[model samples]
Target: MAPRHHEAIIVGAGFAGIGAAIQLKRMGIEDFVILEREDDLGGTWYVNHYPGLAVDVPTTTYSYFFEPNPNWSRLFSTGTEIKQYADDVADKYDVRRHIRFNTDVEGAHWDEEAALWRVALGGGQQLSTRFLFTATGFLSQPHTPDIPGIGDFEGTVVHTTDWADDFVADGRRIAIIGTGATAVQLIPELARTAADLTVYQRTPIWVVPKVDLKFGPRIRTLFDRIPLTQRAVRAVTDAIYAFMVDTAVLKHRYFRRFNIAAADLAKLHRFASIRDPELRRKLTPDYDFGCKRPTFSNSYYRTFTKPHVHLQADGIERVEPDGIVNADGSKTVIDTLVLATGFDLWEANFPAIEVIGREGRNLGKWWRETRFQAYQGVSMPYFPNYLSLASPYAFLGLNFFNTMEYQMHLMDRLFGEVRRRNATTFEVTEQANARYLDRMTEALGDSLFTLGNCASARSYYFNPAGEATLLRPMTTRRAVTEASQFPLSDYTFA
Candidate 1:
């Protein structure tokens, strides 16, 4: 049978895919399909429903600039609320009709002669399109630690991504691995109900106080009535976070004082919450601030003060059917083993799926063999008419919406040019990509990951090659301006 065809094929139906769809529609490109692996939309928000799940970033700055949700229940909205927001956006924008749930894209390749991309789906189906956009989020793939006995004696083993609805933690002894952002949220909730809770800490995270506030009916009504009021609030929150990212992470060498202040704030929060000095020391992060992603929570530190809760800094020696054995020959017997170990960002999730471009250049293989790069964090050299939303140097600030907004601007500019030229295909030139890569490299030289003491930080920011390519080293303002004003000659449209 002949392959189905469209003007564009979008992989993943998350916020990135949704934003891309909205942009395409604005460009008058309506014949596109969003292929989602899950049965529902919301991507990460849909996949993860673990306990204590909420946005660490404030809700005001976490949403699309144009589609602000004035009805957010709290400053840090719950995962369920975020998912609902995504659904509402889709419905409002009329993008839900373009989405195909439970459609898995296994691979895709460029057909040079045909001047189209042939996407291979599971179950041997194929789809062709003029453009392909992979919006599979950075943290889509979960990582399970390769412990020796994890597979054998696991009793009700659950990863955060695949949490079962009926799984109960009440009075059950639990051992959870990883102390990342997700674990920080989950540990406090489990401590409340578990008979015994042990957190296996591979690396301690920097956590500050979360000033989350519940919005009353009055505020919601005001926001709905006067949208500018909500925009003002968003602007304030955005400025504060932007300052933190610009000073602490991007310009660490010159603005080291801001990083020190942030570390002091976290330390003060820890000191006030945890009573035991030893436990406080154990929980303290050794690396510099902004090395890894930081989270905010009011209950996480205090949860450790509970008598039944234990923090095991000793590495995992192995796992037995009954419990986990510590490196110092200690054992913790538990009924439920939770793996909060975060996503596999570098190895498995760079491309997420197979992508073959011009001259048989494999996206994953090329990135691994050389370095991870993309022109303006969207376009690649050999990948014609393709955009990767989760590419390196794409993430701008603490808030992902900032990145998305800028990328949307980029798409608008790029697609506008294509429409102006009446071009059917577009590819970023190799020279332009190289120049952008060099500029990114030079800009990142001033970042905390490069200058600060991040050797001890097992940060996902640094890839296997020891380069911190995760974040773009620029202010959000600059990112937006560049996205809108990039040279048209950088991409060859034909």
Candidate 2:
């Protein structure tokens, strides 16, 4: 057994990790360690450095409840600005002291006899903790496409997540693979600098106008002076977005109207800006609006109008000696290639870790064939004194941080009860978890996400049995209400 110990151990230093640490402090749980794989605290923001990368969500709703940025420069800050925000949050909360940078949590196993988690790190570092919190995000792992001859290509290749600083695209032909969210943001920025840019498209995404703007001096002063003004504004914005999604899409007969409006806007935007009819059709999305992710951008359509930028709709056949080859036997030679393929949102990410609960069964073995199942998206049946923030099916509609606040309150009350009752652990019943998973599957079947209009053939939302196990069908408000109050009777405390 390798040697450090603490009351609690968090596996990441991102929003979820830091947030959990803050919650622990408030609960009077002082002994904790936060382990981050990278040498920084921003998590996903710290890694992805492609040009023009920014938050599609408005700034007003993305901030934490404890701190709000009164002087946000833009409605949607760029990647660098967002990274700076993460740093500021760390500094403000004094959370840096609790973090161990460049240390990866290699594996974690439960010591059944001791009723503690045995955490292991790379290079033989080990620790035992009463509770384990996994803040490792769902989207951090980049899904590198298994294309033929990708490794054989002679050109400079990079992923959008790990962009090199010294890499220059000036006066050189650059090939960009996958026209997903990252590609939409980076394409416009590359079009301005690269001598020639070729974007290989697998499928077109539904593009929406981004209502982005800088906060004026007046608004900043109002937030700084009134203080509560910013909070009120954030609350209102969150409510509006929540209501709009619920009334229009969640359970509505008029949901198709919203889709029609979005489609019409895309058509109008495509025809008005792009002159080539052939290019227009290639850019037009065949999938239903909101079926897949809806990208928001102002310049994505206009970028295609530039003479230096080209979009290849034909599927990529293989990577040639220097560049990408199309299915029609056409080849485009370029100096550099970038893959923005996306992330691995598979359900087996956690099960890949060897976590043994109270019983002798390994978590990986239990979830080997089935998808991930959790009660209220936070608790597993066998795992006691353990919780996961932003777990599968728990991603909030408006702000994830807001949902986290609710979860923190719930855990605080549960732990308080544990202390009061002189209990060592709290474990959910297997029947409850099974029931929740059944409801989750039934709800997703009727939701817009399960519709066959997604751009990709395969989805990250389902299991091998085609059950929707990764997403929650409940509204943000309802989820918080149900999860905020943890019932003691549901678990067998010891």
**CA-only RMSD, every prediction:** 0.8, 2.2
The RMSD (Cα, Å) of candidate 2 is 2.2
Model 2: runs farther than 4 Å from truth? 252-254, 347-352, 455-459, 462-465
Residues 1-494, candidate 2, lDDT per residue (tens digit)? 34677999988888888788888888888899898999999888899888888887777888787788887878888888778888888887778899999997777877878888988888987889988888877677777888999989888888998999887778889989888888999889888889999999887887877888888899899998998998997887778767645644454343657656767887887787778988888888776665556678889999998889988988889997788888989999988988988886664464424566767656656664456677777777778777766466666653567666667766777788888998988888887777778877777655666644654534455555565555567787677677666466767789
Cα lDDT of model 1 by residue, 84-144, tens digit:
9999999999999999999989999999999999999999999999999999988999999
Using TM-score as the measure, the top candidate is 1
lDDT of 2 at 490: 68
Q: Give the TM-scores of the predictions, in the order they appear.
A: 0.99, 0.94
Report how far residue 282 has shifted in candidate 1, in Å. Answer: 0.8
lDDT of 2 at 271: 80
Minimal lDDT window, size 10, model 1: 147-156
- Give the TM-score (vs. native) of candidate 1: 0.99
Clashing pairs in 1: 153-321
